[model samples]
Target: MLPEAKPGPARRLVDAIRYGNSVVLTLLAMLCALLVGAIMIVIADPPTRSAMGYFFSSPWDTFTRGWHAISAGYVALFEGSVFNPDSLYSNGHTPIFGPISNTLLNAAPLILGGLAVGVAFRAGLFNIGVQGQLIMGAICAGYVGFAFRLPPLLHLLAALLAGVIGGAVWGGIAGWLKARTGAHEVISTIMMNYLALGLLNYLLGISGFQAPGSNQAISRSVHGTARLPHLLGPNLSLHLGIVIALLAALGCWWLLTRSTLGFSLRAVGANPSAARTAGMKIERSYVVVMLISGGLAGLVGCSQILGTNHALTGDIDAGFGFDAITVALLGQASPRGTIFAGLLFGAFRAGGVVMVANTGIPADVVLVIEAVIVLFLAAPALIRAIFRLRESRGGGVGVGQLAKGWNA
Candidate 1:
């Protein structure tokens, strides 16, 4: 046999460009999103708009006003998400901790929701019923939290467990339908979301679930014993759910990388026919993957109902289920990537409030920025063309991979 020749520097560089450009693409997408946001900010500013009317007479004034609006808007975002020098003199709590706390508080549920989506993606299943699963879990957890009372530790554990079981059962239903009946997950999941919402509305009308003497579609507040413990004292809203989310991410990392089941899942995802030929139980794998995915989504519910809100409301979802899809896509459906992406979205959530309050920028602009980011992520070919990056050899696990998995 002839000895193999090593790859040259040029070949290695090409390989890196092909396989290692995900991070670069992500950064450029974010920059482009921010630039788009800046334009919207300038357009929305009354002073900038007034200046623009007479741009030929005083171009510098228009430019100056626009720059000032953009800077102020982003500065508020930074202050709300990260730290504020002015917070040093704030009363009671530690300096610069409030913003960080808010970010963590918002990120906890997002991280869990993203993991729910990411895991299903890894198994070549597009589990789009996270919203429904999360709602079912919250319903179970909320009932357990208020109707029955145990010791503080036991009560919390029972509520959390109930949430997991509720979500798993809901997800398993979809899995079973797909496996046995050949029903498409996308259509089934979308239907389930509406079903879940209707169920919640009906339940909230009952005296047992509804808040006493209240006409709103909201459940009774959970008992203190069932509530997630505050992490940084009562001054901050940070809670134990953030710890749970991080631990869940760690567990998911192990589940997808080091476990035997992980190998089967990846194999099935890559090629179901080959996996079946290799003796893997494809049907069983589908059911199991959906169960786990739904369970993760349940944790997201726990974070909201038990950790933050302390009660289940009609708007309890707050669209986190749908946002999880964006998070999963941006993270490339990896555990570590999902964590970072969740944090980034959480920052957007935390900062957008301040940006609106301080800069008078419309709240819709924040949504616009988030939508733009997902737009770029969903179209990797567009990102490649914009950045002039080389495509990977064969095909890579980008949005196209996710789309391909839908057919699988």
Candidate 2:
């Protein structure tokens, strides 16, 4: 018998993608994004560009300068996000945990926002109103934080509760609309975001919410008693918001994996018609899940107002709600995955600042890297094709399936 023909490179590549490992694909995607970022860094560095002009005359110089530029930018990123031994003694002081502190501080709100989206995802809902929910929460929390005169602990608790309630109410509106009117959540939530923005702007211009005699659309500072306390020393900006975020993640994990409500929600997500046939309350689940989702998002507002900003502004959400969508997607709609994804983005944020200062690279480079990462992750097929990864044998959960649960 004739020997079997061997597979060509193209056939092998296609077969590899058909059986690719998701974890490997994700890592490879990140590496590719960084490689693209490194190319941008080299192009943007003046010395590196100049060295390249003399490549024929001095190839070694060009390569050395290019490597140095890339190394410096990445080193600064690490020092800014994680740690820097060189900072052990600056101005005759002890080592400051500024880098890690900044990373945590930046991550806290992201974690909450991501959990909000993740919870909604697990319940067969697409919550695009995280920005609106967060804004409303901030408005309510900021009002309570400044207008009230309760004692320290009471004031903080009241403010936090107010924020949670505000977000829940806003989210519930969309759920109600979907249940009662059969309206699409994606459309309703988007409209609510605009409404929330307008409401914030209006509130900031009012007497009670605006800072005393301030012309800008900024709310009064939250009372000191209501603000989240610093987790480390006064020198560090890190606060108890990180603790709250952690607890929220833990709660989400328990709720999804160990609770009856979680089972009901997951069942509904898996098949609404079947769940309804089995006597599950579909409308109630929608409303309840959205309420929970919005409440978690409200925690983001509290972290901003009570921990980081201490004041409410029209831009209080700072695009975090939208970013949370990316986070939820990257995390595969899992609570544990969301936590790690939030930290990764937080590191990007904290490190980007230092990278800019140290390497003179444009801040846009970081944004590009982030966008590229999301693009690759969202299109796992592209990752598989690029890396020539082998496909697995059995059917598995896919990103498209995760995203298209409700709509698809």
Candidate 3:
């Protein structure tokens, strides 16, 4: 054979750009969503209407007015989510770290839940029942937290263990059904969610789960010993939950990259028939992967119960499970990417509140923006068409591919 030609400098540059195209597209999608949100704000604001009317007549005044509104809104978003310089002097007791602390607090559960879904995605499983698993975890952990009083360290550890086990069992059921009966996880998990909700409602009515002298559907607060210690003192909401989430993310990275089990899971996800032909136990892999995924999701419940809420209520889930799917999708189902995506979504949750308070814009607008980003991410062809960009060498994973791999 003749000597092989190596890639030229221009080709290498193209390869480099293609390698990072996913991240670039993600950023561009966010920019487009924000721009659309700004337009909506302008259209919704009555003051902006008058400014628009005078655009041709008083261009300077119109431009200034529009700039002020958009700038103020985004500024409030940054101040609420990241830092507020004004809070340093105004709020004597509250430190400047308050906003960031809140962001981390919100991000903790999101990271855990995203990891849960991401791990399952890597195993060719759709774990849509994280909400149910989360509820099961809360039930077990809450019971351990309040029913028995052990030493400080042991009590917390026991509650955490109980949460993990509960979620594992809950998720294992779906895996078992998928393996044994050929049941679709999507249908089963959705049904499980309703079952979990109903079970939660029933348990809340019982004397043991119901708080004393209260008719509400709330469990008793956990003992002080079982609660997660605050990492940033009592002044801030930041807790050990964030640390746990980070550690879990690290563990997931190691598991998916370095472990034999991870290799099997990936093999099965890529091609189940080939994996099975190679002597991999596809059914067992499903069970084990789901068990681990459920455990991660359970940690989200523990974070809420032990780290923040300290008690279980009817609405304890707060839609974190559903939000996690979006986080995992945005992160491309990678551990590090999931962590960053969780933080970004957490920032939106924190800042959106301030955006509403400061600018009279509805908080629901943030949801719209998130939907737009997801839409753009889902439809890469649309993005490429709009931006006239070349296709990347490595394209992103899509929901259709995920679904197809389920039976593969």
Candidate 4:
């Protein structure tokens, strides 16, 4: 019997719109997650709910007062992290610039970190040790930034180069072990975490490497010549490093979608045996992909050292490398998507300080909210079932949608 006619282009497009459950489903999950988070926040801190109600009841009376307390508490973290906003002492309005600048400032590292994780996911490699890679990168950057004396721009570039080299070496180790000895990349990367952390602690404790008379296990601040300059006004926290992060994201996107190397990596990731049949070197691809992933992670350290901290400390990262997973997933593994997701995450993190200072809610509540959101995003089927929605083209539901939506 003759085959039935295939659907037309318009019909296929319509079907995809109706059944392609990736972006819409993921967004729905996010909305539901936010609703749940809001409820949790209200439950965790009743006083904030009461204040919210009071502010809602009266537009002008307590609205801005509540907002200021929430957003500008503890001398405005936004100002401290990003460019210092000029305090405009208006009658009622708080400085709105605080969160805006800080959001961009903090988003810089997330962009690169997200890129690292996102690119690997495309190649079917789950690199869980980006945190370790970033730590190693930071150490490398710190060592070069402080110890080396170079020309104006070269000094800064040298530090960044050190970060890339360190991160690449660590990532390459994981790849090499996986290829040569058949070790799982995930396990190897996880082990690398301890290696990175332990080595950093040892190095930071040494007199020559440690900050002078600080009594803390932190590296000395980079020299003035190596520091990333503020893109914003003088003395502002905003720096040119953010620009570099954005540019790097663009570069990664191009490399993944436009380059032959990226194609090989993606092919091997999709099916190693098939790729091998097609004349691709699966082992070589593994090593190359892992090294590139590590390099991207290392850039996070460069941004942290050059733009934000300018000094290396044990707490410099504060789980940002781990958090990049969320950012990458949220962005659906696209470079541009990662930037947007990073901004969203950065906003939540930046605002947490405000929430803590203004309300009775602990900043930990934000962490809880973030975790819940990630959980829901990770398993979209639960969200779909909870919402009682029909299944989309992606059979596994929203989590699958998140996985499929990278190229979507």
lDDT-superior candidate, 2 or 3: 2
Which residue runs does candidate 2 get wrong by more than 4 Å?
1-20, 91-95, 404-408
Candidate 4 residue-wise lDDT at 239:
83
User: So what's the TM-score on candidate 2?
Assistant: 0.91
Give lDDT: candidate 2, residue 94: 36
* Model 1 lDDT per residue over 160-265, tens place: 9999998888888898998899898778888998898899999999999999999998899999999999998888899999999999999988998899998788
Top-TM-score candidate index: 1
TM-score of 3: 0.92
Which residue pairs of candidate 4 clash?
19-393
Q: Across residues 21-103, which tens digit of lDDT does each residue of candidate 4 receive? A: 55656677667666665555545544454566667576564444544444443244344333344555553244445556677
TM-score of each: 0.93, 0.91, 0.92, 0.83
lDDT, candidate 2, 322-391, per-residue tens: 9899888777778888888899889989999999987788888888888888888877768767766555
Clashes of each: 0, 8, 0, 1
* Residue 296 Cα positional deviation in candidate 3, in Å, after optimal superposition: 1.0
lDDT leaderboard ranking = 1, 2, 3, 4
**Model 4 segments more than 4 A misplaced:** 1-20, 46-96, 393-408
Error at 379, model 1, angstroms: 2.4
For candidate 3, lDDT tens digit of each residue in 40-131?
77676777779788688878876677777778888888888999988768856647888888889989999999999888888889899889
